[model samples]
Target: MILCCGEALIDMIPAKTEDAGTGFVPHSGGSVFNTAIALGRLGTRAGMLTGLSRDLFGRQLDDALKASHVDTRTVVYSDRPATLAFVQLEAGHATYTFYDENSANRMLAPEDVGALPEDVLALYFGGISLCNPPAADTYLELAERHAGRCAIMLDPNIRPSFISDIPAYRARIARMLAVADIVKVSDEDLGWLYPGPEALMEKLAALLKAGPSVAIMTRGGSGATAYLRDGREISVAAEPAQVVDTVGAGDTFNAGVLAKASELGLLTPGGLAEAGEAEISDVLAFGAKVAAVTVSRAGANPPWREELAQERPPA
Candidate 1:
């Protein structure tokens, strides 16, 4: 099973109400939540680990996870309110105003990261969960605990504005990178992490040296490239889709790659390190295809098994 760690919050997506005035509609979303849903829909054994509230919105979020077939066995419960993000869209791009202070997810601490079952072969980390407070430190501690021994995949979906202490965040991320087996980062994230005239390849190489066996970089619209620690690189073009919104594209892409890798039994420490170019190429292609289905629609809704049943590659 693939265990996804982080936030599970409501996204107040902008919508046109029947009254014609614009209003926000609540949708169960968060970077890590989206990936877990995508993974479950892709027919992977996925579960979520995060802090949830006993509030109505929290129940709603819980229902969404259960409906998605994402295991909630590892969830931590609280009486706190849920985190809410008010989203604004302009020319199909999205921006957010988060109401996360004192929220259930934000209140999570290091002690809340409970133990996992033996079936959970890999742990996936990312989202604002790694940027926000006590939760970020909690998740980092979890990553540090499992580091080189477990199959770990990280995507620090960078949100520079959300970080209050850049130095601490950077240092923490560098520490996590040291033991990650697979890392999925965007070109924009690379720029933010290591600013200046340094070429993209240089930054990626630095990440590889820190420890990941596979470094995957996604370039919006253009495509994504996978760099193996062994010096092999494979690039795949982004699948075409009528532009709707790009909210969950990257998260779903990570899920897609992981789904394919897990299917091939490559979501393990040794498998990732020993994977060949062909194996990595197939994973990237699957990710691009799955992400295409996500961006072709509205909100962070990912493809369901029935919707993309035929898209599944042979195991």
Candidate 2:
């Protein structure tokens, strides 16, 4: 089973153009939440481990997860308000302004992680959960404790504006990377976190030394690259599609990687490390295809199993 741990919140996306000056449209989002939902939709046995609010937005989020067949038995609902992110889309990309300080998800503590299922095959984490304090510490602790038992995947969907202390945030992420077996990051994220592309290979090499066996760097429509610790690199180009919006594209990509790995029974702690280049390439291509489909749709909606099965390879 894939256990996704992180924030679960409501995204208040602008329903119309800024020139129209309209109210926001609500959608259930949160990096790990989206990944979990996508994994479930892709026929993986996925479950969520996070804090939710008792508000209407939270209810909607739960209902959406249920609709996607994600297990919510590990979710903790609190009296505190749900976290909110205002999404503004421009040129197919989303700019988020979060209103999450002191929200329910931010208040998650180490105790909450104790409820995680014991038989979990892989634990997925990322996003703003590593930005905060007690919750961040809790996630790190869980990652360390379970690192030997299950494969750990991390997607540090970094947004620098939300991070106040860059050094500290990088330190926390380094710790998480030390335990993660699979680390998926974006080209934009690497530029912000490490600066120039010249330093990328060095930085990724350093990350591989930490623990992760495979590090994936996504370049949006240009496609993605995977660097294996064994000195192998494979690249895949994104499939072409009519653009809709890029919301959840990365999360869906994460889901695709995990789902494909799970389907091939490679989600075990060391299984991914030993996977051949051909195997890795196939999985990465599948993920990129899934992301392409998601960007061709609206909101965080990802392709179901049938949709993926019918997708043609990128030309």
Number of the predicted model whose lDDT against the real structure is largest: 1
Query: Model 1 over residues 115-200: C-alpha lDDT tens digits?
Result: 78778889999878887678888988888888756799999988877777888889888877876898999888888878979888
Candidate 1 regions off by >4 Å? 312-315
Inter-residue clash pairs, candidate 2: none
Report the Cα lDDT for residue 305, model 2: 82
The top-ranked prediction according to TM-score is: 1
Residue 156 error, candidate 1, Å: 0.5
Residue 277 alpha-carbon offset, candidate 1, angstroms: 1.4
lDDT of each residue in 232-280, candidate 2, tens digit only: 8999999898889999999999998998888777888867779887878
